[model samples]
Target chain A: MTDISAQDFHDALVAHKLIIPVGVPGAFGRGPVFEDVLRRFGDLVTEAAKNDTAEHMLFPPVIARRVFEKSDYLESFPQLAGTIFSFMGNDTQHREMMNCVHEGKPWGQYQQMTDVVLAPAACYPIYPQLTGTLPENGRLVDVQNWVFRHEPSPEPTRMQSFRIREMVRAGRPEQVADWRDMWLERGLSLLRRLGLPAEPETASDPFFGRGGRMLAANQRMQKLKFEVLVPVLSTAKQTAVCSFNYHQDHFGLLFDIKTADGQVAHTACLGFGLERVTMALFRHHGYVPAEWPAEVRKVLWP
Target chain B: MTDISAQDFHDALVAHKLIIPVGVPGAFGRGPVFEDVLRRFGDLVTEAAKNDTAEHMLFPPVIARRVFEKSDYLESFPQLAGTIFSFMGNDTQHREMMNCVHEGKPWGQYQQMTDVVLAPAACYPIYPQLTGTLPENGRLVDVQNWVFRHEPSPEPTRMQSFRIREMVRAGRPEQVADWRDMWLERGLSLLRRLGLPAEPETASDPFFGRGGRMLAANQRMQKLKFEVLVPVLSTAKQTAVCSFNYHQDHFGLLFDIKTADGQVAHTACLGFGLERVTMALFRHHGYVPAEWPAEVRKVLWP
Candidate 1:
């Protein structure tokens, strides 16, 4: 990719058959091509979901708070969690609650149980369902959902909320590893096909703040996490377009995802960020989406 | 689509290729196909963006509260707004703010001016940008972003927040209408190819309560609201997978989206729900993702 001014880059986008938004509220906001791309891929993905032996299930964005509690996510990563809830008292009661604070009294018991929470990760729903399954072997699930986290960075690198596409497997360690590796290869190739060069690097969920530094160091040391990198605005750092993760037995044990033979399964997961891929394409293919390479267009138009 | 018992449905999912959680949190949680579908669509979207004639740009999720004030979103839909703010104060003061009780003396100022709120719609950003330049013709913008609302329905019908792939046109009414019609056709074919049956129905956005009832009524009366529907549990009332919207300069005039001739431009948009399409696929195929059709497989694999 060559250095291009905002105007030059934008004009290129228009020429390439891309649709760009004039502006949005944030740096990570979306554009017209975004939907076009989603539906484009949706065609292929829906096919993948229907071909297999697994059932195709659609889940909601808000999961039961207790499910997250069981997964130890709260204990493992507190700061990153974007807890969602709303006040429920009627107007008069709500006014009374407000008045108590106005009078300088310690009003306790105002807040009640939290029934729903914004999902922190894309694969949260799969864990709970895996608990009561029979397959001693690994299985796959088809899902699409929004995810949330408290990211306060100007770098679109960490949007407060983002969409995550995940492929999760729970089975023997070797099977899980193989599944992750295969998807990783496909993911990288997809990026390459899109005309963007990407590299795989270590990645980690770094437990959480203050103490999370240790988890970060551990991930760097083990080189277990890998991400497909994409650079933004000529920055040396690359944003992660795809992630391959080996969660080991942490989730399997917690969710009791035992093998078909009754042994605890090892779990691994792979994730792709659709928008980030679009962003990388913008950077790699100049700005014009229409004039993209023939190979990229073939699959797109096909 | 026949009504399958919950257990039988789950078994079908397992047989079909769904990798379920031993115990899932909610009905609409995510899995492997989620990310896969997103990435696939993402590539095509970028292809479209590059080909579009307009320049592309990113936006922030946080909209200036004032923008909403000017747009009348807050007054019209207070229930849907998600305020973006922070508890601004020193550690001691922050602690006090946390302790703020209904009956207690109110703590120090907690709400500071953040100049932002969660973006309700993507077009609001375009209005402000167009104020400075009245492009004579061909004023168009394409954006995809995370949008928020307060619907509490579970699974395919509702989500607290989700991805919105939008193309907003700010030009002459004829031009905007032309763009909308083009997208409407393109979008329908895209969904059809995915094997998810969808129809283009005239549509309208529900403004709100009693007063907005008229808008809803108008939409139904004119068949302005078009939905692509399908059966998930059983083939009955189908879910609206996508919608075509014609704002008729309501927003253009409010935002002063003027053409070079110094006239309020006609504006329109087409929106896509990535998850809904995925859901439609799941319901159409079965819970197990592995059983998808060969045609669907060709799209993803090729």
Candidate 2:
């Protein structure tokens, strides 16, 4: 990864259509730089869509807790998730009793519960909606979602929440795998297009707690996921631009997403973190963004 | 205002690259749609920008709370803002006490106000970041931000929190006026392109208490704020997509942003509610999203 000055990186952002409200934060703490990188990503995803069956889509920033329960998230990955829970009014009233005991005040409110949670992953919604039916031949969905995870700390690359621009396909085994290949290739191509060098390597989600390590190890061993790795802020450990994952029939069995003829759908997804890509660009181009290769600028700006 | 069934609205969305997530509620809470609409609007502003000498710039999401305080927001609109507060070691101490109290008993932990509030608007950052420095030619910057406000009940067009895509320019009197004109025309043109029927009517920000009504009326009388009204589920009152506002020297005085030559930077902004535009699209095409106008589809998807 090349290092660019903060000011130059900022300037390059303004030059490109990569921007959002100055004070707006995506669910997972994405910053302005992420938006700039996403513009480049949107192009890459758009270009990838040219040959894939998927159509681009956007999901709500938040999802209902029931959706997760239906999909079995509470049992599988509860710790890495963030639930949006407002104190139920009854609980608030209970607290009001305590408040009154301490300082004589009656606080009133309505009913509330942990009814919703921010999306934990980009692919959660895909299976639920496509369940019960499958495309005649196959179906591909391109979606960009604000994803959230409950990590204890923040790294520039590993945002507790981030934008996951994904191209997902649910269909016959061959079709889904082929689509993943196309996207993986395209994802690497996009990294190269932006002037970053990346290596495709098996990767794992650093889930939560003790058992998660083994789960991650299993993931890597099975080659369930592949990431486009690029060096950022250092030379040894590289950052990932995109990841390709094959979820054989996991979602299919759970969601019952089946073909028109009634067979479970095979699922594969290509995921990209627009913010990581931007940080990679900053390291590669150095802080003076004006000096960035025209290739990167052209794809991003015009 | 027109009332379209949810299904029909969904259909209209699918018709265009307007693919709504299968189960996520409120696809309208997105900023991308707003960004695109503003892109079209910005094109006009870009043209309008030719009337001035200032260069284009963007901003960051987090603004210091001290800045908000200087602006008198606490005095005028405390209820309307989210003030981010951070947790120090106090929570750890509380957690230990709670654990002791609930030993051998069941109870949830209290972790309220552990973090800073998310930003409430886009403009908050600009005033503070630029307050200390007043450019000679006056500074004109366009900022977009995710804004949050507390509203108990949220409808499709209304949200407790949402994106506020603002195009703001602050500079010397004439220059700010030029920037304002640039965005005004651009905003109007964007509405036309989206094919939504709109009327520029006076508008007012929901100020505190009964004073809000008077301010609302004043907004209408001066035409200081213009709304791009779209009819919605409520036929009698319309939704607002675009708003043009003139702040005169309010922000300049609040933030102390001045020209290099020592004059208050006049300010004006054009705001677009991206979700509202999205809702307007749904209203126009019905939910069978597949049946939406081809041109709009071409622009959004393409």
Report the number of the highest-DockQ candidate: 1
lDDT by residue for model 2 over B117-189, one digit each (tens)?
Answer: 3355666665554675566656655555555554433255665445566666777878777766766666666
Enumerate the candidates' DockQ scores in order: 0.15, 0.14
Question: Could you give the fnat of all candidates in order?
Answer: 0.20, 0.05
lDDT value for candidate 1?
Answer: 0.59
Tens digits of per-residue lDDT for model 2 on A127-150?
666767876877777777766654
Model 1 chain B poorest ten-residue lDDT run: B18-27
Given the true complex, what DockQ would model 1 score?
Answer: 0.15
Q: How far does residue A17 in candidate 1 sit from its true spot (Å)?
A: 9.7
TM, chain A, every candidate: 0.81, 0.80
* Residue B137 C-alpha lDDT in model 1: 66
Looking at model 1, give its docking quality level. Answer: incorrect
